[model samples]
Target: MRAQSGHDPFDLQFEADDDFGPSSDADWRPAGPAPSERREPVEDYSPAPRRRAEAFDDLDAPRPAGSVGDNPVHDMIASAEAAFGDHALPRITIHAFIERPRTGDMIEHAARDRRMERTSVTVRDGGLSAALLAYQNQPTPPLLVVECCAAAPELLAQLDQLAEVCDPGSKVVVLGAANDIALYRELMRRGVSEYLVPPLKPLQFVRSVSNLYADPSAPFLGRQIAFCGAKGGVGVSAIAHNIAYAISEGLGANAVLVDLDLPFGTAGLDFNQDPLQGVADALGEPDRLDPVLMDRMMARCGEKLSLFAAPASLDDDYNIPPEAFEEVTQKVRAAAPFVILDLPHVWTAWKRRILLSSDDLVIVATPDLASLRNTKNLVDLVRRARPNDTPPRLVLNQVGVPGRPEIAAKDFGEALGLIPALVVPFEPKLFGQAANNGQMLAELAPKAKTTEALAQLAQQISRREAPVAQKSSLLAGLLRRK
Candidate 1:
């Protein structure tokens, strides 16, 4: 979350591997006679190809071809699938410093999708002091990857500075200019997790780092889910709030609900409390944010639920840039076990980034012609926007309204090309009473039909309950119990 809060309205999306072994999980069959190698305490790296294809080509030697499904990589992926399940973002941050731009770009592509919360690039520049200063203000992002050609003498001071600025827990990876065995040994001793010779492929860079922190136990691999609407009145905020509340309290997990509905956010209203500063206070000064700063931003609602609520005012235009979002969410990812973003029913560079990069997505909708169409388009667009992410969950809401022309549940699902995970039936009486009382459905009317339904939805989202055939009506269950 290095603070560069400017929206590069310049870059567009649609932009943009691996076999490995015990040697850092990306065991590449190193070519013929080994080239000269060197190692050191402060720094280590031999020359590596700057472009992606060349870097990976070194490891592309022929092996028995097998489908990704059968590969160990894919098996790990499948077992870890629940962590990548529907409706939330996985928490992982990758910060890389590269001396060469092409090589840096290649590395960026290889790691962009592996469910990383953020991949930040800090260009290698001037000298050791400069690099240290550039990264000083920022918290040592969880996984630090540095590609440099600096000499051992020069790297010593740089590592010292990095050690000072980096948190004790941060993982550091170095890519040096030459295969210096001594330098490699030295860096590993100095606390760098891994060091590699340059002219390496994107897969090499990706594989080594991924191996260092591969499971949920690793620091930043939690989940981050963002809730958004395809159109206004699509019930995005309400659903997001309810889900976050359930995640924190019902599921016994630590959860943070961020209300990005800035001007008109309903989080405070939904949770029934007003906090001092909301998203504005966090984004207003992106540089000053840290775990302590985040403590100042949150308003605790219950045992495990906290909120970064939006300031409900138009005192000044939010005009928040994309970078502001990057910083806030980055900090949120580091601190919370789960972060839920209640995005407004609008599109912008910042919002798009939030949606596209979030670990999981939930689109709430009413089952009508307009909701169906907008949800369908949103699904398609979001799928494209995040080619690497799983599809967004569709929540069909307010179904079976009396005397209203409504889309049949099955027909609605068919039209959208996605089955609705939870069909929340119409219950104006209970919903209104709960809202008026400033209470969650479980609290306001725990026995009510829709409230019961909300609880089931929460269970499904938190993975406490897996998906199954269509559910019976909560009202019917209530009657049966009676």
Candidate 2:
């Protein structure tokens, strides 16, 4: 694919052969199926006339072969492509420096195809030095993507000098031949937005730059709170729904409730919304999900609350990648200030990532050995992984079930070294009525203790309250012994 204009941004090639990585001969190839492996022919590749123009729509379109499942890179690229559509190019400016001819061509193709409407993309030859010299007197664009054909030390040195000229708010991405983890870590520590090695997958390159411009510290971006159950029948879905409702109604925050238990999700029933279209629809075609599409998919539960009700179907098994979850939640999060993920009681890599990455976490568990064991493990994993964030809030639900021989709340807390933030008594009558009526607990019984507890939890999360303990207690030793 070629650039759209005569002065194509990615047309130039660098003259340096200094060394892109430790291994000088490491070849570059475009991402996805190798060239020799593509079986389909590019038959009649003209895109249908639309207001927006794309230089390489055919490349971004779904491969006739199938989906690019589970590739985080692919998902990120897809999201970037949508954001940088021809309509959004005018306000953004991108500067790309390429060392390899093929890499330049591939990047130029992607930039023209996915660039925001009216956005200017300037590609020049002469890797790092060219950029340094170019920006020595001129102002750097909002984004700068430069290539380096040097080893780690040289690359780092060049970047240090480049940093001197970069504007305070400008973001930088590095494209090099280096694949060393240590170098990657050091680059990250020194504040590099992203590093990519390439024959240049156009999508991946574009996505990396797009991510650099996504201000992670912005307050308007939604905060994801992953809610999971310690054991089955622990009412995690119910708790998640209530929390979302409290956030929306009581706290006056726009909230999105996503039910992820594809097979047995109760979000639809809990909210009294039919499952015509929702999370399944969004996940089915994640690449198509934008704010408008997401708004159409959500079922508005109240003034500020929307629900992405799961299909909860049993006819066919749902085999979606964890990346799908990341994709859907990411889009949905952008639509509201608070995103409550009703995660299913299943432990998987995707689930683990969601748990670890959430801005806040709530573990709904009952007082039992199984709940105790699972909750302990989950807390341990979270505490170790997210040492800086507050520990996951533990909610002891259904604490007083008659003749159930339950564990004591204090013992449960001591065992996990995490005191339950809220203890909800087993009130079957209240829950059953709310479930049957398709109303949130707070709506059905606003003055009830459970509703008050739910509200408190919401405040804690929204306000970023400190945890009682910074580290888990020694109860982990007892749990292991048991």
Candidate 3:
């Protein structure tokens, strides 16, 4: 029967046995016990010892705010100013695990700060436990923030678990409900970077983060002051060059004037220089720029002032990218104590970026209807873009042009919600002579009101004063022995 069906004889035997039932129960025993669940070893939960030694050693020390002459306090204030100035935060990743909604909102708002524009920020819920769980197998970021709602002992224990997962060199800031000094000291001893009690403001949080990364030993970066016009002929370039000269000559500080108006810049012409290579060259090859190359590219306008003149040529297209401009400006600022950027009236991405990033901005506008509207728009953009910074300084240029209908300086300032820093009247002969001679207002007429005003503006922006000239005394000359 099996041969006719073309089936195996073993299959036929098995079918016959199934019909008769199993003779023994040994063939159907259950499988072995399921494999035990895998888990990380408990021994790996110990706090990292390497970072404990690197914690702030002066956590318990009393920080005294001394008088004006105190060097320590002055140093501290200067450091804070540098951190809050035009210098942007370094590139780093931040992960914030916030449990309280209030703190979470503040952290989110702080992430939107201009200084944090280049930083990577991530906010998540569940606080320390979530951080502990998430970073068990993965690496922690450069900065880690967590909110703990527990008491001192429990918080310290949880922090131990958190420290185990944190990679070496990672900074940890804890947000807690307690304001106890003992708790703060203990946490610092255990390698906590900072411990803050809640009710935090966004700016305060930004300051804290900035202080952590500020390097006191780092080289100084110059402050940039950008000048732009509301219209094409508002004298922005001339003002910028004069300010640069004043800062260098009057205030006795090294300053560099960079002409960003590639096609129609007047910095070279105003300073009476014809450079071989200038700002255009630096922008063309930003990657190759360094202090040495920058030195070679600049023309020495004065003993303390350097000029990065523009090509002022229309023969070639100036299609440099926005990032290149930023990179070149950064390099230029590094070489001096103060930098003046002469921006053209044309609007572009690079121009906007430079204006917003400048430590100080000056807008030169004529007292005309068109200038009023354009100035209003520019002020609004600056306010919206730089919420943390002060408003742009306004310079009322050519205030009294005879027979030309003009808005009063007071009225213009009222409309813009800003007072005019300097109101320069229409002095055609003085300006014309200075331009023709390639001399600043101060050089042509030292005692002129306009020259004094320009000098005062320079002093105000640079936060410095010119050395008082000693009056020539006949008695002093007689007193000197031969």
Clashing pairs counted in every model: 42, 11, 0
TM-score for all predictions?
Answer: 0.57, 0.54, 0.76
lDDT of 2 by residue, 1-482 (tens): 11123332212332122223322333643333233311232211112322111333222222211122333433443344334321223367878886655556665555553223246778788888899899888988877878886766678777767867777667688886645544555566666777776434545455555555555464345778899899999988888999899888888888999998888899999999995788988887888998898888889999999999988888767777788887788777778878899999888888997887686788999999999999999988875564323457788899889989899988888787666767888999999999999999888999998898788778766653223445766998789889
Q: Whose TM-score is greatest here?
A: 3
Using lDDT, give the best candidate's number.
Answer: 3
lDDT of each: 0.64, 0.70, 0.75
| 328 Cα displacement, candidate 3 (Å) | 1.3
Lowest lDDT sum, 10 consecutive residues, model 1, at 13-22
lDDT of 3 by residue, 115-182 (tens): 78899999899998898899888988999999887655567767766755667778889887655554
Candidate 2 has its poorest 10 consecutive residues by lDDT at 59-68
After superposition, the stretches of candidate 2 with alpha carbons farther than 4 Å from their true spots are 1-220, 464-482
Off by over 4 Å in 3: 1-80, 83-85, 125-139, 148-151, 176-181, 197-201, 214-219, 468-476, 479-482
Instruction: Give per-model CA RMSD.
Output: 14.3, 18.8, 19.8
**For residues 110-216, could you state the per-residue lDDT of candidate 1 as single tens digits?**
55444433454444433335556766676766777776666665564466556666665677777665454444545655677877765454434545555665565
Candidate 2 vs. true structure, TM-score: 0.54
Candidate scoring better on TM-score of 1 and 3: 3
| Candidate 1 ranges with C-alpha deviation above 4 Å | 1-209, 212-221, 465-482
For model 3, how big is the CA root-mean-square deviation? Answer: 19.8
